[model samples]
Target: MANPGGGTVCNGKLHNHKKQSNGLQSRNCTKNGIVKEAQQNGKTHFYDKLIVESFEEAPLHVMVFTYMGYGIGTLFGYLRDFLRNWGIEKCNAAVERKEQRDFVPLYQDFENFYTRNLYMRIRDNWNRPICSAPGPLFDVMERVSDDYNWTFRFTGRVIKDVINMGSYNFLGLAAKYDESMRTIKDVLEVYGTGVSSTRHEMGTLDKHKELEDLVAKFLNVEAAMVFGMGFATNSMNIPALVGKGCLILSDELNHTSLVLGARLSGATIRIFKHNNTQSLEKLLRDAVIYGQPRTRRAWKKILILVEGVYSMEGSIVHLPQIIALKKKYKAYLYMDEAHSIGAVGPTGRGVTEFFGLDPHEVDVLMGTFTKSFGAAGGYIAGRKVREGPLVSV
Candidate 1:
């Protein structure tokens, strides 16, 4: 290429015009420190690059792609700046729209879920809400939005749900068909779901005694007695059996029912390490030595209380070691088989059966049927050293 005045000649042509990706040209400008713009007043001029001088300098596709990329970059940059000023750059309408598409509408599909649920909540006293309020705020609702979380219209759903953790049905009795239910139904028909009175105060019905008989048969014991609940069985019997002056050696791992009952007995309570024969013997030996010298009062009726199975750890007690220790120290023993009754031992006689020990080895065997049998009461099975124990079960 040559300049017009024959000043020089070169293969490359000098471009007279330069264009930006936007197809806008830069105003007449400088290239190599040559002045491109003149100042006017106090303002400086900035000009955009526009159309290029030569189209043959680059391939058509390459040129078009570069221009398109530049145009798109400018467009997005403007949009971003615009949105940032409006404080909406971070919000995505597309994302919110996608989320809205995935919801289960509360009103459209789940009706009657309203009244039954609200009534049930009030009936159950779930939150312990106030009972004295005027009714039907729903009569004035144009739409639903509350001054608080929920409007006065409906006692809005406050709590999500209740999970059943304390049902305590260990044997899954509720799920069984045929035999257990049939037995329960037959028994219920004969003796009502519950007795109308207490045992000492006319609460004890014939069915109550019958159940006790059934329990004794189950535990293979001479006698058994039932209480309204598993907790009551121990609560009442413990104080009656052990007087205020007696010494009771209890295991540290014994249940709260045993703890409360023993406390109520007003007995001298001594606790040994859980299931440790050595620990129990130490206490028993002390009682025997101290009880005799201090008073000639039958040398203290020493009662040893323990659980047949530890519920938390699912550990079984060594009945042989305990029974042997009881005999060695002339102590009467009580065993609570709450978690063991129907699970341990060969014939389901609990720890006694598990150890090949006779039922007579335990002075009193107490436990609940709400666990293994899937039924709802607790019983104490025992044999008398002097008189034969009678069972109403």
Candidate 2:
């Protein structure tokens, strides 16, 4: 449904304006939401009159100013690009050597322009250097930029007692003093870093099998496979599950890793509105009615990709509704619990536990230990028949 001010009226709630990852602000509502606090002059402020159960639209003027700010930044970027091209301003972009003039440029000029004139001005807020454990409170290393944020150097100063809100340390297990820290030290001494090979070869350790068993037991699934990294877990596995004749109904706001995986799968990818069961069901219905594109035949398989918790929006998935729809449509459900596992639910088992649904209802459950366990790696759990193929990926 449409909103009064050119936004989507999501679930009857008018969400506060939030800066998207691309630096553009969006006004989409968050599910199972929380009121966001606004800071003013280094002081935190709250809207005491607003009801917590209902979200209010950001002030019209605030939205206006937000766009205006971006517009101004874009205009300046264009002007800077013009100046640099005209040789009025010094060019900081990478120069092509005379011998390699025929070679394609490594980075696009427009990308460098946006980076220099737009992102660089606000880059300090991201990729900050921290000198302490990413617990509730940590230490940040202060640095200074002299060349208009083009390059930065250490100021030899540390900002102490900083509250951590950026990291995915949802369980506070990343603390240096946690009991797991001692266990990690002991394991590190014995393991000596990594296995230095792929799991398909000599890299498979008894501890790896033990961890996979623990993960399967944790999710109450038949079996599980662990991967070295969270991003690769999704990006590399989806292609193994489905291809050419398959259709993937993915949530619009799914992580980049999921997006990459779907693209790599050689499947027909269709996007459904984020966290909306109605939108998802509509897509599933259309897929069934229309069948595969061009061929006018039934798809080999249909995979539905969703996240347990949308990391950027802090929105929880409607797991029960989605499960019902997937079953009705006879589609496969692949739920990524990267940010939800060991962080939400009665026992922190994830959305399935939170909604009191059987884990098997979700065909493939993917999650990362990086967030909730404060550990590295990710896992995919399901029936042994379903997960068996992913080993080849």
Tell me each candidate's TM-score: 0.55, 0.82
lDDT of each: 0.63, 0.79
Tell me how far the alpha carbon of residue 91 in candidate 2 is from the true structure, in angstroms, after superposition: 3.1
Most accurate candidate by lDDT: 2
The RMSD of every model to the true structure, in order and in angstroms, is 39.1, 12.7
Summed over model 1, clashes come to: 18
lDDT of 1 by residue, 1-393 (tens): 222211121111122322344443344545323223323333223222221223236888998998897676556555754685499864221122456757764354224333322332233322233222112111221222243212235445443233334444555655447786797789779877776766779787777778778878887777788776898788778888887678889989888899888999888898998667667777876787667445645544788888888776566665655665666566788889989988776667687666555687678899997887776778888863433222222
Q: What's the lDDT of the predicted structure labeled candidate 2?
A: 0.79
Query: How many pairs collide in each candidate, listed in order?
Result: 18, 0
Worst 10 residues of 2 by lDDT: 43-52
Q: Ten consecutive residues with minimal summed lDDT in candidate 1? A: 132-141
Candidate 1 is scored at a TM of 0.55
Q: Which pairs of residues collide in model 2?
A: none
- Model 2 residue runs over 4 Å out of place are 1-56, 95-98, 104-108, 111-113, 386-393
